[model samples]
Target: MEENNKIFDDEEEELYEHFSLDVDPGQTPMRLDKLLAIHLKKSSRNKIQNAIDSQSVRVNGQVVKSSYKPKPGDRIVVALPKPPREPTEILPENIPLNIVYEDEAVLIVNKDAQMVVHPGFANWDGTLVNALVYHFGQLPTSKNGAIRPGLVHRIDKGTSGLLVIAKTEYAMQHLARQFADHSTERTYYALIWGEPEQDKGTINAKLGRSQKDRRVTEVYEDGGYGREAITHYEVLKRMRYVSLVKCNLETGRTHQIRAHMKYIGHPLFGDATYGGDRILRGNMFSKYKQFVENCFQILPRQALHAKSLGFEHPEKKEWMQFDSELPEDMQTLLEKWEAYVQHV
Candidate 1:
């Protein structure tokens, strides 16, 4: 029972949730999972089923089965792994933002790889949240009132890219719906060791935290355990040992691209979490080793960048898209690889 209420680690906190809802007075009786599917657009049916199987779904504070018929006015609570942390008072910081586009409703900013998106355990300050609070006072918070405010989506600290910020409550709801429905377009570029067999392919797998290591997210191939994740990859450029590829995400699971790439035998270069730090393939000479080390120094973080994002304007109802260039580190890494692959 305690396992069902376990608190998520820092990373999982960004993507997971602890939600509570009161069944509408006019709500029709329905299977727990089926009812939840309507409310949880971001949650896959399999995930809700697994939550029910693990006794993580509760009705009026009592654990229930997936097939249980939810009655009107029943208070339902679901833990996607666990509950959120006690709220922390967010303090503003004068950190600068590279605002790409901004209006009354929304803003887009290109984030640096080193900055955590929001406050969490071990990361209270120097976050994008602090910057947001300083720049734009009093933004909308999540329904649960977790630390996140104004953020409709986030990227990993080690993965730099574009993120959309909601400036108004209505904008928040609008963008949130887009992400939950998988209607938002997000493409990431990554440098990975070894090229995938097919230039264009898709990775369909389930992702959940590894049992042996709670800090790491792992791919679960078999059903009944993890959330569905899909990443469509197209190789953009190939050197001898490494390749640059773009991944279009269908679902935004924690570490979806990193874990999926590792599962498919092509972990991103310099991704210390997924065994990409070590030389996984190609020339084994001592000179090659030194060259690899040099490349690692050029890009200390995972060689992944959020390259583009597309979404509909919440108020205007017009489609909008934004793109970003590779950061200096990733750009230099590729230039070095280009020389080395050509035997320079």
Candidate 2:
């Protein structure tokens, strides 16, 4: 039994990963760098491309050009250097990042839904790192020696869309000060579960950490480590149950959008924890309840996306603005609701 087990382990170690390569006859001669990026998960396109440019990659026993074409049965050999454990930031992930614009000092990255901006306890990998590491050069780190040196402002774990990050320490400090002074203009698009009786309103409430549940913040009336929170909202489109509204933050607070929306009796769609029961019960929007329920089942949380951001470049003394469109999932839900309303 011991001998069999040893033999099994030996076979697994000796097994070479094998993959077949196929190229179309008419397709212009593709580069070796492109081939490797498409083939290997352990390696990225930029790394392989750099190696080829530096004359490090070999094909069929010869140093070849990046655009070298391979004949049928050609043996391609890549002399890949050992990649660093922690590489520098790279391009915005093709992971559907909605980039508004970019400049030398900073880049506006429109974050996707359900993406954690920086590394934390629950998420170590498969994050923006997997994208930034492959896209840009290594960013400058703080004295603390942690990665993600460019990151300046951070949205919530589940919130989506335009958030700014500093490309340099000077830029980072300046942007941080902007947030401190409440000069940055941030706007969010939310599909709430209820229609506000008024077309526009403000939620002025003091928010503090809930003593019973430290994880959440609540509208504290008494003794609590609270801060002044204010949110202004305007209805863009209205349905029987759900209303699409644009929310502006007067002050940045934890869960400001979720909490303020709920306080106004218009919790965001699919928000289960923060008073989204109206949408969940599938009773309010009776005509499109089935569609809304299907959307809720597909979505992990509330329907909120950061649609626009405008702020001054602290260093450059220039105004910068960014905008992101609603994602397809949310768009589909809106379409269904609109169609249902039209039919009625």
Candidate 3:
């Protein structure tokens, strides 16, 4: 027999879950972590071991190790703590969603611009997670019992594009493993400020958090501190000053495309975070400046979209892929640039 319950704090920062299990009379002795992993479908053996090391797991009111094995009739109690600052209570909102595809195991959503994918500090409400909770109700948790729900990957709040979410623990685990193994395919469309000298190229660099601004990521030339990131890009259309490009990602690091583009002096147009809002490549004429500003107004955020995503289905074991069209803002911005290039 097993009993489980969860408690949340007022600020939604910390979560505490208690699990009590009575050993079966016919059960053979097994490692505590392995047993806990079997009992908690959302938790992994490593997470169970961490709980045991944190003195959060006890057998018969005594702290135990990962190697501890339980006998029949033993009373086991486990206390699990979630990551700090993560919301404990995520309230569902009646926000509209552009659901592209959905099945019992997975869901593909065409996430709109200006939507936060998950709940975090300073962004607890009006997030995609809130809307998901409202529509779907009580999603499966992560390995550490955190309420990511069905999220397998995330796009930036300003970026619009396709996202695949897992609806079950098996799907979550399987998709997570695929992403970790770099087997999933992701492609993006970006409008960069300057035209690249080469039509197609690859930017291989290590990425890490910038010391100057902790909020953004930067490319590390020395490969000293950051993880490896690779982005392959090809010029789709050149408008003399700004060019539209397609980028394929080999590794999904934070700000990989934005940072890599900036490193090559071709940041995505209107990307205020990486010095792309200014007139980086156009002429000094006031008319050109006004045109650039107009384009900026049309497409305010970074002109990047997660255009496509491909992965293997967890349940069916079949390869699945999805694509999304560019949002209206991006389309209008591109049209303006094309007209300007043709007239000038």
Candidate 4:
């Protein structure tokens, strides 16, 4: 039957094939299934199981189980399967938010620090996505199959800033395309440890994951999973031991400002991960040391805020921009820091 043939063709195309095997001298052999997956870029344990079940994989001209191990000279073949398709899950929640701007196609919200954009391990609820799902039924899915829905771009969990969320598929596509073209205007304010000699400059670096610690990113010289990141910054104000800086993002990379600032010897105040020791040390008060030590508190959180966002509306074809003033906590922190300088 033509339908049966079509199904078989699809299955055959889905299966991986002609995987290579290389074993070290005087070493025990590893499983053929593992080798095949590594070689053919085919992942997912279920897909491997399905391939083994259909007898589409061969180990040295012999059909083998999924657990079969291969020797150094053994030739391996695997049938790669077409990736399975799954519907996107968009759950709703009634989380609090500070919405700055909203139109039919797009929304700009002042994303508070410490809130994730979507769900993951250890953070299933209280995300921006959860709030959006509660407000809107669903989000536009991306062609690249990113897990988070409605998010065109992202700021870090600890970075408070204006974020754009899409309301429709058409808007999502257009906005994503605009971000890809580097037309969106994004700027932030941060308090850093020291002042740079130049008022305006750019930090161009390649970033990648750290091999020693997968959780942290590092500036890689040889380009390991790394991408080019550019951050333009200007000194807004210079204090006795700290400086206020404004940053413009040319390329949006994870921890771009934090990492790049640290790389340039001006880590953000209250940014423990990227070196806020200067802020903590500079503000050392012997009388308050015991209290701060007991509480394990430092600069509340890096004094970073998303000041402005600019973009073209997806449906209206109108240029739009929104701004958010500093929250009370940040304003208070700045006030204390400025007073400390005035006394000296």
Q: What residue runs in model 4 are displaced by over 4 Å at the alpha carbon?
A: 1-71, 74-88, 222-225, 277-299
Question: Per-residue CA lDDT of candidate 4, range 8-33, in tens?
Answer: 23235544443434353553666766
- Between the candidate structures 2 and 4, which one is better when assessed by TM-score? 4
How much lDDT does each candidate structure score?
0.87, 0.68, 0.87, 0.72
Cα lDDT tens digits for candidate 3, 234-300? 9999999999999999999988899999999999998899999889996889998888888888888
**Cα RMSD to the true fold for all candidates:** 7.8, 19.9, 10.6, 9.5
User: How many residue pairs clash in each candidate at the backbone level?
Assistant: 0, 7, 0, 9
Of candidates 3 and 2, the better by lDDT: 3
lDDT string, candidate 1, 94-172, tens digits: 9999999999999999999999999876787899999999999999988966868898899999999999999999999
**Candidate 3 clash pair list:** none
Global lDDT of model 3: 0.87
* Residue 106 C-alpha lDDT in model 4: 87
- The local lDDT score (0 to 100) that residue 22 gets in candidate 4 is 39
TM-score for all models, in order of appearance: 0.78, 0.66, 0.76, 0.73
